[model samples]
Target: MSLQLPDVVETYFAISNGGDLSQLASCFCSDATVFDENKTHEGLAAIEAWQHEVRQAFDFEVEPLQALQEQGQLTVLTHLAGNFPGSPIRLNQVFRLEDDRIRSLEITPC
Candidate 1:
């Protein structure tokens, strides 16, 4: 079944919290692109690879504080905390969904 933006976001949180790569891949479009402060990943292959790399680098949880849909984008404010001092990073996760999957994702530290 096709999922809404919120559903996709929730799935991402679940998969991330669980560190489940397979589950995480399900939420992205076949041609999805994800961008973070360091790098950009394109397509399902790159996204999955990047997910694996990120999961290994950080032990954290992305807790969504606010989620809203505006102008074809889903914007979320989240708190990220884990193996770092003052790590509870506040960030924005903005997503663009296409065909019920995430087509683009941009994360910015806030």
Candidate 2:
């Protein structure tokens, strides 16, 4: 399927909800990078490994609240929820897409 910036975010939530690492990996470039919380991960291999590990821990949903785009990037506001108290977490996802795959993602809690 052809991927777009919004598709990147939606696919993330979908794969995450299904706990599918392979599907998640497909959304990224081979050298895609992700910055979450305070940690930075380089490459789809690392992102896939990280997702595999973290998916076992958190069961949050990437509930899209708002979305904005400029140039070739998209910034999405979402709610993350799971096992923790006050589980519903608000966050922002900044996505940069290259050839329809996510080239970079920066996530920050709101």
Candidate 3:
């Protein structure tokens, strides 16, 4: 399937797959937030730490299967596959953007 995502959102997924920690900072604003796995990560430093923790825990790749935008929020249906338990799973990634950067992101089960 083909889908078009906002520039920042596209870059987020690209960076996620690339696993380049340095480039990950480019996907979000300085004070960005991420809500995932019942934990909240605030600020760029926290987010980077969260990403690093997850990378060490699960070596996975995310693919955006579909995207929906409304009311300033973009929710993308993403598929993850890797060596983690279940092997593959789908998640709903809700992103709020600001000035071409991701202001916040929340990942929920889909």
Candidate 4:
């Protein structure tokens, strides 16, 4: 979709797709929060744990299909496929960035 995403956001997708836990955690601010699966994970420790659990539970890949930005927030539409139910689904990832790091992210089904 030719999305010119911010560096941090691009790094997020890259690390996530590669299943690199350390690199994924590095893309976020220390106090970053991630909202997914109807739960909130706060701080780098929590975010890392959440990412680890999810990655271990499902082998998934996210492909960015579209993107939109407003103020300091960027929302990307992504196609996710994995071994879980609904092997392929569209999702919207809303991210808020600060100082080149992801401050917060909320992912929801599209």
Candidate 5:
């Protein structure tokens, strides 16, 4: 079944997949933060830089397998495959949206 996602969230996945990184400003709030790999990236510039580093290092594809949203937070279970040590793995991405834009996101092992 196709999971329904909010417009901003959909745009986020689109950007992550193949869309232009310049479009990130439209998808994330100026103060957005992303936590991954034990590092916290704050602000759009930092988030973009983090994305660039991860995309360059892993070249991974992320597919959302399941999702649940409560209040302003959405948690998605994703399958990732790439050049990393583990060819494939599952992770949980928790996103907090504010004013229709992503305010924060935390990625952790499932």
Candidate 6:
């Protein structure tokens, strides 16, 4: 089934697919956090840096397939393909949003 995501989540995917770090950074709150690759990046600056590093290191695209919301969190299943070790993979991106901004996000293999 297709999931109807929040505006913030939709914006996140849009900016991410566009590959605009600056616009992506604007999708989060000042104290937002991102958990990926066993690392936690906190705050906007760190998030921007992490995005920059990852974007530069791998040429990739993310296609959000579905989303599920529980409590205050939303988990989205996405298909990612890139130049990384595993060329293509499916992952779950969990997002916690507050005040129309993403407060935290965690990504894991699906």
lDDT of 5 at 39: 93
Model 5 CA RMSD to the hidden true structure, in angstroms = 1.2
| Per-prediction TM-score | 0.87, 0.86, 0.93, 0.93, 0.93, 0.91
Residue pairs in steric clash, candidate 6? none
- Residue-level lDDT for 89 in candidate 6: 97
Q: Which consecutive 10 residues in model 3 have the weakest lDDT in total?
A: 15-24
lDDT of 4 by residue, 1-110 (tens): 67888888888898788656788666999999999989999999998888888888889889999998888688999999989998799999999988889999999998
Candidate 1: tens digits of C-alpha lDDT, residues 1-110: 22344777778878777657887567998888999876899889998888787777878877888877889999888888988567989999999988767899999998
Kindly list the per-residue Cα lDDT of model 5 for residues 8-110, writing each as its tens digit. Answer: 8888887777678888898899998999989999999999998788778767778888999988699988888888896699999899988889999999988
Q: Each candidate: how many clashes?
A: 0, 0, 0, 0, 0, 0
lDDT of 1: 0.82
In the range 1-110, model 3's lDDT, one tens digit per residue, is 77888877887887778657787678899999999989999999999898888888877899999998999899999999998888699999999999888999999888
lDDT of 6 by residue, 5-107 (tens): 8887887877666555677666899999999999999999998888888877888888889888899799999999988998799999999988889999999
What's the CA RMSD of model 4 in angstroms?
A: 1.2
**Which is the winner by lDDT between candidate 1 and candidate 3?**
3
Please list all clashing residue pairs in model 2, or write none if there are none: none
lDDT of 6 at 44: 93
**What value does the lDDT take at residue 105 in candidate 2?**
90
Q: Give me candidate 6's TM-score against the actual structure.
A: 0.91
CA-lDDT, candidates in order: 0.82, 0.79, 0.89, 0.89, 0.86, 0.86
User: Candidate 4: where are CA atoms >4 Å away?
Assistant: none
